[model samples]
Target chain A: MPNRNRLHGEEGRAYWSMVLPAFSIYLLVMAFPIVLSIVLSVSNYSGGKMFGGEPWGFAGLKSYARVFSDPLFWNALKNNFYIVLLSVFGQLPLGFIFAYIIYRRLVKWPGFWQGVLYVPNIISVIVVGLLWQTIFSPNGPIAEVMNDLARAGFQSRLEALFASVGGFNVDDGLVSKILDMAGPAALDWFSDPVPELKELILSYEGAPLSELIGDLCNLFVPRWSPEFLSKPNIAMLPVLFVILWMYTGMYLILFLANMQKIDSQVIEAARIDGASEGQVMRYVILPALSGTIVNSAILAISGSLSSFSLIFAMTGGGPSRVTEILSIYMYNNAFLGRPNLPLANAISLVMVVISFILIGLTKMAEKRYGGKEE
Target chain B: MSDEIKTTALGRIGGAAAKAAAYAMMLLFTAMTLYPIFWLIMNSFKSTREFQVSQLAFPKEPTLSNYVEAWKMGDFGLLFPNSLIYTIGATVGIVFVSLLAGFAFAKIASRATKPIYNGFVIGILITAQSLMIPLFLEVNLLGIYNTRFAVLLVYIGTGLPIGVYLATEYIKAIPSALIESARIDGASFWRIFAKIIVPMSMPVAVTLSILNISNIWNEFALINILVSRTELKSLPLGIYKFSGSLSTDYGKQFAALTIGMVPMLLFYIVFRKQITRGVAAGAVKG
Candidate 1:
């Protein structure tokens, strides 16, 4: 027993020594930033002042308040929720369905299907943004389809009648004017630098479908949609679309792998018990996948919240700050926001807090579900 | 007999219908997944005018000008080597460090070190996003901000947690007797690790290396922030430059994206099973 204890002590020393270097590195690189961000959040320092002899002073929660009260911040927050929801509900389910179909039901080459789904995930976000931008551009294929649908000759009589009632006259309506202007001239949708599209959209506040159609027509026609990087709202769409597209495969792969682990006998039993396909999916598959569902949802939410590089590359929070997510907001503040070092640090702190809350909540949920399994 | 035959026939019909539906869904998703890539590749060979005229359709007359233009404009020749060096160097460092740490955690008989081992798990929870600012400051202070070493160091630091976790889990499955026998023969800890643990953990190491290689190769944000010089930028950053320089040049941009992604795509194809298994294992474990 004494020899065993001595051996254990030796082992302990050896283990600690091995791990110490890596852990120390992680502490400095990871923990230091988090602590520093907290310190900076309450301080007052601007760009030149940061580099100069300006002393850090307490500002309490002023930066947080500033972010909370800013309309742009609220807009970005709302947009982020929209993105999160879209990813969790829209993309996650679609990915699962795709993964399920490929992995379980489909009898063909699974590798081929896997590769196909993973293409977007492998491509860079900038590339995805550019591809979608081209596809959705007025002169791009989708717009051409819309244009064809708009033409009087192309529409069915009932559709034409509905269009007229909807105030979409091919000859006189905003849609027609937009198609004429942008189809030929190539309109900048997001960044006109003149803010014509913004004005047009903001000006038509009360009208319903007709007004939106008019604004879109004006936006898409006559100019190339502002460089995706410059126009925040328009930029957000393609960026979100690409993100949704790219991550669908990853989430799909996860779900499919989990689905594979579900005992085949259980599924067979469900079938043998006369459960309909829909019923089997609703009861057996979904419940069995609860862990993954919760995990993926949390991941998607946290991911959307922390996303930076994509938005930075795609939009950069421009066209007057329409597409700024918290991560990008913090980054812009730190690196480019008037060189306001204190404010940037404050934003980073707030970001960390937000991420911590989100991840903490996820852990709680994971414990609730995963606890039983373990 | 007729009734039984009828039931069998109905069952066959139902199965056929389900199979058909499944195939349709798979085909549709496959198209959605593959079409963009196909379109990108096709666009690479087209002139700007051809791309503009038909985004989805095949080129009227294929041309190599886009690829040539993208290569020259993107400066991929310089970017590729920089990325290769960073990715290879970082991956090697990560694999070595993680293996050592993982072995220590898994095989070492130390109750006192459990907390420290668990602490690395916390590192998994703290992503790079949380520490970007501080890391930048640290790198800058260390005076290696724009150097390849800075980026490589960051990768090693960020990658350690997951690498250690994976290695520990894999190494734990190995019996302690194997190491004990080696030690009884008077083998040193280093020898045991090198000859026994390393050989036994080859599969996991291979999987880990591939995962790290792909991740480090495609990494953009850290490299973007750390490397200020354009020539030293990685593939993802190089593609970003291509996008910025030729903002309006869709054909060339697509060409560059296609070109840059080829290596990863090829890697995936060659090692699909290993890569997917590694990703799945990492995801579930995390």
Candidate 2:
């Protein structure tokens, strides 16, 4: 009795009107922007070019080259990977452990803790950023504890400037060849007393080996500044903490929901076999949850690459760009700086590409884990 | 008999230790989770002097003056209405459009329909980063760059893809006999859609509404770029300025934040069930 006719008439006309509005909006909002970003990236776009101003022109690959060459660009890319590391390496395992504890009834009031932990995810990023600022402020809790430790002669937490960065690779650099030419003086990096000298060749941070400017007089510098939050080497610690806090709850909810879906008899069979709790977890529970783990891993990886608002609110990529990620860097270019639209577009395009690539890698990983993309 | 008794005693002690450890773990995590927000609320009520003296202590004298001062400073009187207008207007637009499209796709079979639905589905994977530049240009081309309506359009536009996807998927599960019966009675497409499909799809409509409202309301990146007019800024955009506004008075800053927070928190608490369901559903779909 269904009118399964396949002819075009008034029926088709009505259908087009119904669907076109939403469809066109998607095309205009999502699809068009992507094309425009690619186009603008390859062209000259700056300083209100579109709003009744100068005409836009093509710039070719100049902007792309600039993006790749800047030290800050490299820093942003590296920082993005650090975020990826925190999400994949940091959030997933912790989220699973918490979810396991609650699901297996190893902890009390599982529902209560689940809801409490998820509270942060719903709050505004601005609030989370400011709240952590209170904890990380120079006179705030974390720094105060660090200061107390320092006063108690626990100086291990304090970083040494030259020795703290990426380690030296004497096997690969021109510096190594130069050291061979300059005799043993250049080879102090290999000597036992100058361990700090050995760490210089690791990367661009004081790579020349003579950039060591320490607090020799200790006049202006305290042995330990309470302003630990401002230090470039450690500013990301609080950001990572807040990130782990804000997101782990959502994943916990995710993993627990997956855990509930698992068949109980399988677990019961293992229990009846006299398998201990840890063994059941190690052998049975973990393998069953691997699919959800892979799915969330993909989610976390893509999410990390494009993260902006939280870091922007907290650091604004400041204290000398220590926490600057690619999105923040692009935002600075577009809205904050001279409104370098071309460069910003180039960066945005690159960010999209990177997110796609990361998502692809994770998808391949998901396939290996035997989970289809839902 | 003595060895068995000793083993039983050791098991009792071990069980007691395990229970205590579980309780401690739960309590520790609960504190870690809630303490920061708790600090925000407590400080919001404290005076400047107290805030300076002890960031952690309970307020010696709780007062509402900070709230009053902050409300005036933030001009929430204007922002609250703007935010409400944006949230309601965009949600309504998205829901209506999605319903129409979803019904068409689900019931009205056509050749082009399949490809169009697939197109919208691809929009899900497009991050805001990629869209940021072109959206700015599109708004400029349309000459709605700083207008509140521009923000509304973008919100509805972005919300459409997911809304349509969910609605289509939901409506697809309905029996085709309902539509055929209405068609046999000579009812028009819209009439049957309104009378039959609309009532049938209420469950998904509700889900879509909750998901759309939360996402549209909390959205920052798109609205931040589109709306430069200070008076037209939505709640999230407006609250972001507090980072710079009250950098000196920590209490007043927190008070402004608390004001910014109270509405969303209340909504979450009231509809916490809907929210959790929506989030879980989203996670499953993603």
Candidate 3:
């Protein structure tokens, strides 16, 4: 028998031929760069020939210091944190509930539900980002709906004011009285009281309050501005919602597949025992899915840490860099105007460290709270 | 007996309520997921002026003008082919390399197998963002920057870790006795692989292709960093530029988006089963 441990001729050649193609590429692209990234993060190489003699020195944590000191980095990190929370807290639970619904056959056409829900995930992240960006833009559907509602509220308020005033044509004195009560915005509409008035009323949807009655009526209208993409404070809100929307489908499918592996007979036996549906979910299904849930959390945390494409396409980290995540920050640093390679490398290393720490915490949490491992 | 009857009645009511809640949740989420895409397609058929007049209203005159204009202005004619080339090239490379390596790791008893396999597996966590800087330098050093070859190399390289890991796990299940018998018959390793392993590994090969196709097709960061030439830009980059240069024309923007989206959606519909199973398997196993 040929010695299996030590391949002599053909066997060794075959192994080398098969392994070298992938291994060399991995080493060249991933493994080598990862190590190089760590080293370059500490070096003072800002740009220019990387290995050639062009202003290369040991920066020694300077890049990291710069990253920490930049308030933009903090904002970016904060945005990523919100996304992580959304993924774990928002998407996972919603996905779980959706999966459970489908798994238990609680809804009709479960396959249709499953297929439709997962559609967003399979589409390109950039496309989904652009689609949501349009939906939240000033001229988009949400804005249209909000504008319509505000206009409707304004029309009703105008009707009430006219009813109280006895008529629309009540001389200049009555118009002044109406202006005093409804604020200055009422002046334009009260003057024409015709085709132009409709446009005038729509334009004054967020008109300032002048008196108690205006304030009371304005509370019902609640001025709707759909300029979210440019607003620094809340730009990430739409991004977060989109993240929740695009990714929940993936986790749903993941959970559904894991749930399918659980024998239906076990669930049947539980049901036959006098356990209610809730009880079955708690005792049998939840316990069975604890491992999958933990795994999904790890995926979520890691994914959250590295979120780029969607946000990059959606906001391009705009509105004074409010929507930037670490990845985008790192990307802009590396590729955008005046590349800062060292700082970009440092940011990436920081991302790696954070991902590991978060993933490690998840695994630890799983060990503690997750019922006996399957 | 009366209490038992009352409890049963309560249980029945609770079950019905739960079912109703389930249906509501499903309907609400599905609508949220689909409505935007539907809205996008509907508006893509309208002129920019019509869209501005009533954003939510159905197009009074659905025209193909937006689509024709977008197709011309976005240069989707060029970008679509570029995307396909990179996606297919990288996916094919990953699968071929992974299958070969997986067979070696599984059937061949080597001291180098464990460490090499472990090395590839570590790449599962090494995201593209982390490696972007060094890879840019490496691609430049290799003298293939701004070339499709560079993009393919990076995609196949970055995608290898998971591909190799999945391939190895799948191939390990195939009986070694088959390979041993083939070897005893004086058949060459390549011959045996061609005859036995290649056919046996089809399921994994399909899964690897699907996973990589979707990933590399939609990949933006690498293509953005590696390729600067306009001719080489993929659909994502094309659409991104369109979003900027044509920001005012919502009709063309929607049409560009529709052009980018429809092919993949069609692919999903056709391969609905394999794609989902492939995606679920890829995620769970990886």
For residues B1-286, what per-residue lDDT tens digits would candidate 2 score against the true structure? 1123223565557546766776786678779888877888998899877886667778889999998987777777887888888888998888889989999888898877878997776555557655676688788888888998788888888788778888898888889888888888998888988898889988888777887776676677788889887789877776777775465577788887787777777887787767766666565534
For this target, which candidate reaches the highest TM-score against the unseen true structure?
3
True contacts kept of each: 0.39, 0.47, 0.63
lDDT of 2 at A137: 77
lDDT winner between candidates 2 and 3: 3
Chain A vs. true chain A, TM-score per model, equals 0.72, 0.74, 0.82
Tens digit of per-residue lDDT, candidate 1, span B241-263? 76555766877887887887788
Candidate 3 stretches with Cα past 4 Å from truth are A1-5, A51-55, A157-184, A187-224, A355-374, B1-7
Which regions of candidate 2 deviate over 4 angstroms?
A: A1-7, A143-225, A358-374, B1-21
Worst 10 residues of 3 chain B by lDDT: B1-10
Pairs of residues clashing in candidate 3: none
Q: Give the candidate number with the greatest lDDT.
A: 3
B138-236, model 3: which lDDT tens digit per residue?
788677889999989999998898899889999999988898898889988889889999999999999989888888888887788898888998998
lDDT for predicted candidate 1 compared with the true structure:
0.70
| Cα lDDT tens digits for candidate 3, A191-247 | 653334334334544454234334435533444668799998888889988998888
- The most accurate candidate by DockQ is 3
- Fnat, model 1, is 0.39
* TM-score (C-alpha) between model 3 and the true structure: 0.90
- How are the candidates ranked when ordered by DockQ, highest leading? 3, 1, 2
